[model samples]
Target: MNIAEVSKKYEISADTLRYYERIGLIPEVNRNKSGIRDYTEEDCRWVEFIKCMRSAGLPIEILIEYVTLFQQGNETIEARKDLLIEQRKQLIEKMENVKKTIERLDYKIERYEQSVVTKENELKRTDD
Candidate 1:
């Protein structure tokens, strides 16, 4: 598919896709004779992987390093695994922080709800 099709399919902007390619976050896509990008299945898979990793809050530097290691062939397998493990650890930490924030918000919401109910009850007594 072309860049536009790939961008729409992946819900990513074409400029971002080009930026990824330019930044070595993903492999360069093959261009057609007219100089338009023609995204093959492998290229699309790389785009998907990059998108997923980015969505998970993985840093672009780490992803670029991972892609560099990936392109170096089989010898970097352990290095790649180690890099991903570190990223996963960081992501887990972030997830924990987000969960705590959600819990705090839930507590505050419940408190406000209870306060509203108490005020309503007091108003009913005053009305009677």
Candidate 2:
């Protein structure tokens, strides 16, 4: 596969892929005889993984670190695990905060509805 094919398969732009490579977020891609990018199955798989992690709100800096550790062979496995765990913890905390905000919004909406009803009742009494 080429860059175009990889881009279409991952729903990512070619420019973004190049940017990832340039930023060291991903390994440098191989080139063909004409110097065009020659993406392999492994490359596409890594792109998909990176996209998924990014969409899940993982920071690019952390991803770059992870990639660096990955390039250093298997000795960095523990560090990689620690990084993922930390991100997961942060994501959970953010989710909890969102839930609290949603609850507050729901309470405010209920109070507004009650106020509207009370005003309607007062208007009806005044008309009597």
- Put down candidate 1 lDDT per residue, 59-113, tens digits, no spaces: 8999999999999999999999999999999989999999999999999999999
Per-candidate TM-scores read 0.98, 0.84
Residue-level lDDT of model 2, residues 18-106, one tens digit each, is: 99999998899999999999988888878998999999888899999999999999999999999989999999998999999999999
Candidate 2 has an lDDT of 0.93
TM-score of model 1 vs. true structure: 0.98
Give the Cα error of residue 34 in candidate 1, in Å.
1.1
Q: Model 1: C-alpha RMSD to truth? A: 0.6
Against the true structure, whose TM-score is highest? Answer: 1
Q: Show the lowest summed lDDT stretch of 10 residues, model 2.
A: 40-49
